[model samples]
Target: MRQAHRFGSATIWQRNYYDHIIRNERSLQPMRHYITHNSLTWADGQLHPCNPSKW
Candidate 1:
């Protein structure tokens, strides 16, 4: 964080994060897809300031 501030940059990570446990492959597959495609499927709103249209 200090280095980023010094370089006039910002970090994407927050101070806290959630941790989940995958007991088996079945549960892990969906989460993997969601995480990989979340940004690609973002909706047009305040949360997504770059592109207002869906891909």
Candidate 2:
């Protein structure tokens, strides 16, 4: 049966399949860049739903 989303859904979350530790700023910069870049290029990605969030 289909379930109604009474509380909405997750649009920016992922399963915690793994974990990492950032002991310093240098260790975290790359990850920050990755997320920011992804946001900037999300609309052009083939996996994006609307090529931005969802189609």
Candidate 3:
């Protein structure tokens, strides 16, 4: 957020973030897997602002 401000751009002027709460293992495990592979998955997930492809 501070970086965006320093760049003279509002964070919201760019994109939104996606977050999920820690649930039970069934749910948590998938999120952990996602986090571990975020870079590989970014091209096809909501986490990448430039990627419109769905997860």
Candidate 4:
């Protein structure tokens, strides 16, 4: 908290980071796609700073 206050940010990190569990290939494929394409799809991604769309 001291570092955050020093840097003038309300919080230095999110309350929680996201996680996923892959049990099978069906579930794994999409995760692989997203991880591999995150950079390429940044402009259209849900987490993109400039993107207004929400997942």
| Candidate 3: tens digits of C-alpha lDDT, residues 1-55 | 7766788875555457666787788989988787789867657767567765642
1-55, model 1: which lDDT tens digit per residue?
A: 6766999877657678777899999989999998878867665545565765532
lDDT of 4 at 22: 96
For residue 9, give model 4's deviation from the true position in Å: 3.0
Evaluate model 4: give its TM-score.
Answer: 0.44
lDDT scores for all predictions?
Answer: 0.74, 0.72, 0.72, 0.81
> How many clashes does the backbone of model 1 have?
0
Order the numbered candidates by TM-score, best leading: 2, 3, 4, 1
True-structure RMSD, every candidate: 5.8, 6.0, 6.4, 6.0
With a 3 Å backbone cut-off (N, CA, C), the pairs that clash in candidate 1 are: none
> TM-score of the candidate numbered 3?
0.45
Q: What's the CA error at residue 8 for candidate 3, in Å?
A: 0.6
| lDDT value, candidate 2, whole model | 0.72
Candidate 2 backbone clash number:
4
The CA-based lDDT of model 1 is what? 0.74
Q: What's the CA RMSD of model 3 in angstroms?
A: 6.4
Which residue window of length 10 is worst by lDDT in model 2? 1-10
- lDDT of model 4, residue 1: 77
